[model samples]
Target: MTPAVAGASVQPDGALHAYARARLADGDGALGLAVASYRAALVQDPARVEIARRSYVQGLESGDRALALQSAALLDQVGMLPRDGTLLMIGEALTRKDWAGAETLVGRMVEEGNFAFIAPIVRSWIAIGEGRYAPPVIDSKDRFASLGLRYADEHIAFQALARRDLAAATPAIRRALAVRSSDGAALRLAFAGQLAAQGAKAEALMLLPVGSAGFASARVAIGKGKGLKAAGAAVTPAQGYARLLSRLAVDVGSDKAGGTLALRLARMATFADPAGAEPHILAARLLTLQGYAPGAITEAGKVPARSWYAPIAQAELIDALAAAGDEPAALMLARAQAAELGAEPERQVRLGRLLAEAKDFAGAAAAFRAAQAAYAPDQLPWTLLLFEGSALEQAKQWDEARAVLQRAAAMAPNEPLILNYLGYAQIERRENVEAALELLKKASALKPQDASITDSLGWAQFVTGNVEAAVPVLERAAAGAPTDITINEHLGDALWTAGRRYEARYAWAAASIYAEGDVAARLAAKSKEGLKPEYAAP
Candidate 1:
């Protein structure tokens, strides 16, 4: 359109100079200008959902359903929004009786792990709706233990009543009671309007504890809902109370319990309000920490595109996918946000790394090219150049790789990682071995803890014909990185060349398991012969 003309368009200010000036046709409400301006900005960058978010919120407050829907779609497209929107969106979907849409929204969030905390509650509703009278979550206890509140408590109560096991329901009801202690009220509420919905009367008669107005409010809301609408409205205020109970449970639960609780809460948030990004983020992070890659991705998927948390959630998702060896999928997700994301160079670098990890060298090369283009005017540009060199070297483009690496080394001479790798490469090619040894020495001093650098330094010592000196250093490097195939093989080789035959055999034997390339095979064959034992530990 024109430019972002806010409410004060009389003269012309910051926004009017932007594309939103055309949207001024919406008239002069506080939200009108912002909506117009943001939409205008979106026209310039269709993938720019954050700007559309401003329009969406303003549209919602202005009661412009169409505009709100548009923005909401944008949020979905961009993948980040408040969790509160979960309740609002699903509630509206239910109001229109759009079962498919509701299912898609709710199910997507659950699958994405956004509603981890409230998952049990949502599952309870779904099960109940499907006529499963007593559907208690096996995971509920652990989750509730963390949040200090168990949605399963309600389910267990209902299940006990279904089985006529009032006694079994006692413990669960008791737990809910600890949330505020109202005896049979929580039990009764759990049994509302279903087949064998016991405890309903008891719940109606239940009152909140003497103190805690918020708790009382929530207790009443839960007691009042007969169907889903009332339940939906009831959830907003109740969540705060539940969250407070959750905080109480934070220390009360173990890490496993907390993880369970986080998952349930995320599910509940998604089922009830699909728009909340934090719950999804929380779920994704928890799952990631727990080493559940698929679960983490599912949780991250709950975020709306318009959220401020979108980038963080995306970054986490990408990391998880990469760690899980699903680099291709990770690249797809990250690339979509490349231009708009804050750490443009970082994201590009990450993408390049992922591509390399996947063995898609050409794709990695392309990624480095794009990343190089997006590099910020800072240290990152230099960093990207290093990454480009690495990628090129991996693809065996030695000439290009060498040129770039030389440039990188000169630009940031202090970076030990690059220096060690480049210097080691030069030694391997037998080109500039002396210079390579010098660089490797510096690298060793810089990162004494780095096994690779130590190995490189030791390798250089051996190459320079200092066999006796290489023995101890190579051995040390091998021990430090026991699992490293290269270090083991090198140590074994150094031992043999130094006439430490027996130790060489043992070293080579160990190396066989962890080593790669032709050396490992060669060592394996030699170790089979039971070479003489002249080697000492020195």
Candidate 2:
């Protein structure tokens, strides 16, 4: 027995136990480490098919393609490969231009009843590559047909583009656009590029919807006679692979899976095109959304400095730093970006937001002022004015705050939040009582369920000698916002004025639980001595 210990004996039981423990301990946030630990465990017992399956998925999610491939090979040898593993293997074959191998894998996946909707697109692409035109047939009766139609049309257009058949591509693009009103951003961008390449510059520009700066920039590039050949085309194997990955990333990123799959796919895209900033930008955004700030920062840093996406990546990096509680670093980066951008109102607004978050109200106000100076008279966002007013209020510049808030209220007359804020500020200042009441009434009407607005309305009534009317409104506000200290405090004052001393004491006790600083002290005194006659309603 001792002599028979040839090489290293695989302890399947021990390895399986370790893998189970690691799986249990590895939470979603530490997925990268979990995948590595899984790989190490698998190495100890290579014949463990179940462990191999899990390792393959974890590797894909963590962007460890080699590990995924290795696990896939192991799973295939044991007849335990899942549909996803088969797809990955097929993708790898396609990447290497091994069309025969991809076809074989695709056949196996189809036989297993997996990804029935997607399998045909792979076949269609393969057929187009072989100089045969075989368009995918999507049955509308199929359960997945609605979801698959847009992807099918888009892929058909790509195949057409690969074959340099603009006539064929145009109709497919139109079919895709017809499937969903708001479904296409990347698709439209690619189609616009094709239009521009055909010398239809106005048509291309018209295709680009408003609010997409990326598409706008591409329109500018096309206008300069840069020709949309490169932008519109994905004929190369690498480009097709990257485009597929980006589409999958978008689909998966919208779910509760929290961007892990999206980030991995984007990472693969970067390997396909190192100079392309889109993949890196997508990865950075995914990481940020998943609360992996450090990872986001690293991905954002990978974008080329001269790339069109660099500024956007930099802004995301700054936001990531701020979200990660590195506010000082965020502020420093924002300031640098603002200086570099030079009178860009967007950057100025970003600087103001960062400063406001850091409690540097004066600095925030200054940044907002700079933004206001840069904007044309008619172009200022009401949000900009609101932020400026709030910052000035925080900085104790009351007159400036009032003036800014008034202008904001004028511009956004129907905005409930603006109305509520200005009205509450006026009430606190003990000036413009009638105007404040009117504003609060409008806000309450606009947002009937809003507890804060109701509280403000109730408090206004109390301050204006309508004690009985205040009591019911304050009661409703307190019911809606059971834990809001201000609402409870106002309810307590109203109850006291309505001659319900015991109920008032109970309300003050509730308010005390959430009170802090000066409010807490005031509540404590009120609870001890009840309200003084001076504080009671007339």
Candidate 3:
């Protein structure tokens, strides 16, 4: 009912429509709705500098400083904002108490200055909360000290709160408020200890949420649920916080470290805010821990239920399951997420692999075929053939496996994994011992310290009637992998063939302990029967 509305009605549908809605929502004090609409508007007019700037401001008005900062970053990504704008956006986001928008921002700001000013101050408050000294960094480290502006005292107080230095934060707050009696900046300021992260269900709190809903009830139990519960009703931001952290970890290439951290955070985030992506992210992590393949593919099973990230998570989770020998589970998830995941090249490759892993060779081939037809530069088809061959071989369909593998080898001649697997399979089947030996030798050269490769080399040598040479190679192979029954057995056989019956008996005896299943049991029984001495020892 304002001029902006009148102008919007006649304006062609685009960014302004969304902005109008945001303005309406803002007037109503529907902070969450206003934030959403403004963002939607900004997305449509990404190139409009004023719109981009206003988008961030609107976010702040809704008490979602994180989202506001993120809008600034999006503009930065499009080269719309100046460096100072980026710095300012980051600064504003970090100084806030409510992190409802944290799922969108924070990291961009942290990188601007390594949080030299903010981190220490927050740490100071955290220390005070637990009865400790404000760190040297708080007293002298923050770069803000260099700025020496009127807000220096307040900056220190904020940093202390960020660090959970409640006592230090309290004094700084007093000094700051005294200096600036009516600053609107402190509208939603929550106490330091009251807003610290509380494990899975209770992530780092906003410490300031006078505007919208907080995840006070919905909580997760990342790894330390009891500790989280102990801090109940206090901290607990939006559910997306855990997923945001998880995504950031992948972005920064710190997966192993990130994975551990994500799992803990996700448990809390998912529990605290199940409506968000936290659950899906957590599910993805759980699947990874449960022996699924690594990366995006093995993360579906651990996803919190009903999350939008479910399809993405499923794609990753299925691949992991397939790689790890959980074929059935992989197939089920792949089928479920196929429509949503098929568009992604990596997901397509994973889908193909899952089909093959499940011995649905036809399905695997079709997936690969589709990926190939799509002309995907990543080349899912080549890997699909390898998987198809493996599935066929597993089913004792030798000819089919051989055909598919040969094509795969032709397509990917230099790939070590494919060459090694094919050569090893041929060796086991007694089809091409010489070729298999050559292939395995190449693999050994590529990986000299690999015990399995060394063992294969020794086996090949023994089969080729080079017993004298096989003995030392097998001995080294055994040394590299002392617990390998195959290596020990090969050494024993090589020794036996090389006229060292006594040594051969000792080697076989050693092998018996490491052996298992039918072959091991048979070998153990045979060794127990005592071999006839090749000619009675003198």
Candidate 4:
């Protein structure tokens, strides 16, 4: 499979061989190799739109900026530039100070009508670059009219503040923040940072609401009489363009199907303004969603410690580390975050969940208890009680677990999850069998389609010597959740009680497929020896 194409002397089949290699690498999740192979294929046959498109996407995913830009240029040459390509080309035009060229690209984007609401904002920036800045006309008839108006007011305020026109900036920024559809936290941080950058620290402090976690870094800086420098202010045309694209990346990412497109836009925004935090955050989230853990961590880590979104980025970075199979690092980071943000109950809860996932049940319970202590008495969350109780139970603290579970059950009396859990735990311990059966029945009624709750009810019946009743319910549970280990094992026990030895063995075999440790040994023993003779069926 050596190249045979003209000027491509490395492969026999040239582009075809390279394309096949790229697809194979991509299918194996080797994005770096995929991007390189795709680039080599495109080099052999520059007109291959499919190869160019794949190279462009993989380049962005793999954090290969050069390959992304090269493919974007190729897409533009073929007049088939995607949204991200159009944005990159406009950024290039802006860098070259080609206002007319940027506006021409905006015109093409408007004609396409996919995300045309942003065209006016892009044009406004281009005009500002051309020394002809003006307030954008809000089209009430536009599809994204509300969004357009919010950004329009935001830009007006930004320009006013840049010129030190306090009167105009005051009302414009207020109006923009009043809409609440756009990211108010980001807007506040940006506007406040702009004010600080302009030496109006007092005014910036006034704009940032008190006790806003997102503004923690900014508040500290402004309190120190230090001016906070933001990456984007809509003062420069390129910065304005990057700001809008980053916001667009966030907006587009709300749609589950638009992740890849959102990542492309986020990467393009980063390319335009490397220091902007929002685009990096958006890219991190998109990368996490796409299962690119290392890329997610890198993007999240890019947020400077002094950035307004630093806390959020730090949290996301910890999560990315856990997703990347570095739970020890994740736990270390989570513990540090909890210690630093002692008043934030959510951080403690996050730490608790991570500890539980790592099988440190006692540590998890302690973290959950800490979260509970951090919360005000009136604001105590029942969910935290549930988590703490579950952890304590796993740690073999039966009395404390029961007490905490009862408190959770009292707080959320009708919650099916709480009911199911409490019922299942009681049934397992052979405590208050009749009451546990009632709870399981209520939970089953609340969530009719829940196989787990149904399995609990069936198991309760079996342990109570209602073997005839248990057999049918366990069969139904097994059918509902065919591969669930617990459900299948319970079905085996119920079938064995009903004198169905062959069917019991079959059920045990199914459960054994995914069982491990002590459960695996127990299932294997049961499959060979059948039901114990401790008092068969009464």
Candidate 5:
């Protein structure tokens, strides 16, 4: 493809050179350098709309607030500023406590009708900052009506707390929490911090859930009478509004509607409140999902180590580094985090999951074992045992894997997954065929809709010399999960055993579609030669 800036051949200038450099850096994934070059280009040719637009987006992606604001100003001057750009302008006014300027921008937002839902909220904050205590009125018909109302009330609560009006703040916070869908833990923690800061330590302590590792630092601080020093507490209208924007970002992200708008809101939130951790974490997650791993790492690395979200940010950073093709750095960071938070089983499990994703099965098994050791032998959870057994199995430690799986099965007798795993492993190892068949039968019964479990039961039937029954069961399994290579292969074996030679070849052909390596070779052989003599007659 020809470069858009290939116009460097036509009356070249410094701006053209810088624009070409920026485009190259952008294609090379050096987003920070791209933003810098774009900024330089814009500085050289302030009238270049193309340069301004490119710099505006790259600035947001690279977390360059100055560049974003500079480009945003140029765009606004030409009446080409996007809604989010206008938002950035409003946020800047709010940050500097320029109430009149913010009100003017809010008027612009209202006239544009692009961000109408949030315009009222921003205007309410501007009013509050200007000493007007009018309540926020949300239109019940707005698309984000619930969220708008919830966040407005939350801001009011924060504003009340700042005024030491606990009588009003408490109920507003309670109303916000009631409307919140996903546990509202962050709100509880932040509100608790504000309460502690207001000398209501007992009330603050009551807001936190007992025995949560993330709240340990906050709890200790409040206990020591030092007040909660966390960064997320909203002590002012602007910070409260930032928190609300961060929540809206998460809402948009959850819809899987693409990350561009979510990242915009997240970047705006981070700019509006530099000390807040949630916005940084949200921005990092969105960037990572969009395959901008370097940008993700930068966002995650912004969270202060003393904040409540530091551990979450560390995990995000490790994952981002791994995604960026720096596995060694990811491993080093994961190992350091696991060691530091070794007492927390959750962190160890996260490390184990990361190792598993990296295909370091033995390391994953070892991490899972560390997680197991965190619990008493008698108190071990079946889920942990299952994870350890699966990792060990993948690591080729079959003997230990079987033992751990057996323990898991005994602990969770009704769990279809545990039953299916143990039964399937026993069948593969050709040990205790009768017991394996019974286990598979129960698993198939427990989860009739599960194609894999049904496939295991049918395979067990074929191994037990029930060819007639196996053929139909395997057919059902194959029909349920038509794309499943293993199920189709198992169906082929059953059909071949039952003398349906032509249909068996068709089944093998279906299984061969996505097969790879040895499986592909074996499927090709099966389609041509049927089964081996001993297996041909079941």
Candidate 6:
């Protein structure tokens, strides 16, 4: 008998041993080993629904579908399937063409008071499989109901195309598109396919949007006289099911329920259409959102080079690498893709960000400059300019940094972060004290709760000889960020200037705990001898 079939009768001590091993592996980030240990633990304690559920999630996150399925079976046996688990089982049933099983699972989902938001979409899939269409009830006040109505219309369009009812499909498609611009990619693709089926290849080509770039190969296949049926659109039940599932996955991923179920749904969509890069990209994004960076990288890396989504997937992989703290590898990969980076200003910006994170400030500044040069004047956003300026500042190109920052400030004068950074830089350099004070005040007003901005304001006041006025501001800043070395040090300075000698020494000692090198030495000297004449109150 397979491990899935084995009875749960092992001793408690044996189960505990396996569970401890699983916890150790998980803490070490040996996720594959952790999954194996979890499975072993579950086998030793088959009645432990918590262990089975955890094992199932680990299996899904690790891309071990077979293990996930086995765990799902165990969860079912123990009556512990959650909404997401029910969706997984339903997807599995749909993949196997077990329509009755999927319908039963859907009913179970509804009774559990879960997935009610997406029930209409699920029911539509069922209706499609049963060779019928369900008209969605539109409730403008209810967000999910609105989504259901839009999705129902799109599915109806697919049904119309399947039955060669182009006139009926066109209006339905139009209504679906009118619902939301973001949700129209699949609808647009399906409509284009239907047009191609009706011998309107030129019209279909014109109707294809940039979002349909992922389906370029399929479009080309259609143009070469392959019918919609041959190209895998709405011609067959399985193809239609895959397309619907892919769309549903996108919807679910963007919803408030979060990405766990969405990842599972996207995984199923990939199984339904392994040739499509869209589903893989969706799965990768959902995996990233779920904090499975390694899994995200793997899924994104699967997109073939010829597909339009390949570049997108590659970018996502780079982000996942950075998220996973493999910054050196991310930098190398970014450099390797330099040829592709030239045309993609956003990619260049991302490379700059990675370089910045790696502390290669000079390289980061150069990358930001390249991005700036590549972007059209109208395309340059304030954030990009701010990043370039920040990178230049870190690289110690002070003149260029100040100039770029001034330009960014001009563009986004009300941006608190920009105001704070620029103000702090000016104060640090002891240049234009009044101007810095004005900027800091503006920033403080915009974001009254920002400790850094508060600290800058107080530090400026202290440096400018307003010892009494600085005390309260610095105290607030210190209270908000008690462990922050700079804030603590500033608080110590202000306290000393206010004649609170004992408190100043105490604050300086606290600051010294987290300070380093020059700051640490300065705090130490201040703790022993008080503020020097230059820093002393007038």
lDDT string for model 2 (1-538, tens) is 1222234354555665556654764565566677777888778777877678778877765567777888889988978776556666766777777878878877987788746667667777667656688877877898878655657777777777766677887788788777534435545666677667776677677777543443556666777967466665555444555666666677778886737667666766665555556667777777778776776777788876644355677777887888778998989988987776333666788899999988899999989988787668788888889989999999999999999999999999999889998998888787898899899999999998999999999998888778988899999999999999888888998898789999998999998897898888888888888897544321
Q: How close is candidate 1 to the true structure, as a TM-score?
A: 0.48
The whole-model lDDT of each prediction reads 0.59, 0.75, 0.54, 0.80, 0.82, 0.73
Residue 29 local lDDT, model 3: 49
lDDT of 2: 0.75
TM-score of each: 0.48, 0.68, 0.47, 0.81, 0.74, 0.79
Which is the leading candidate under lDDT? 5
Backbone clashes in candidate 5 total 0
Model with the higher lDDT, candidate 5 or 6? 5
Clashing pairs in 2: none
TM-score of 3: 0.47
Candidate 4 lDDT by residue in tens digits, 1-538: 3233335344566886898789899888777688888878878887878778778887777767778888888888888777667777787688678998998888877777776887778877777787876767778987789778756777778778767787889889888788644456666777888887777778888877665454666788877755455422446777677777776777678898888788887887777777777678777877878777888999999998866778778878888898889999999989988887433677788899999999899999999999898668678888999999999999999899989999998988888888888888988898998999998899989997888988999999998889899888888989999998999899998898789999999998999999998788788888888877531221
State the displacement of the C-alpha of residue 131, model 2, in Å, after optimal TM-score superposition.
5.4
Rank candidates, TM-score, best first.
4, 6, 5, 2, 1, 3
- Least accurate 10 contiguous residues by lDDT in model 6: 209-218
**C-alpha RMSD for every candidate:** 22.2, 7.3, 24.5, 4.7, 5.6, 5.5
Say which prediction, candidate 4 or candidate 6, comes out ahead on TM-score: 4
| Candidate number of the best TM-score | 4
Off by over 4 Å in 1: 1-275, 305-312, 322-328, 339-343, 376-378, 516-519, 528-538
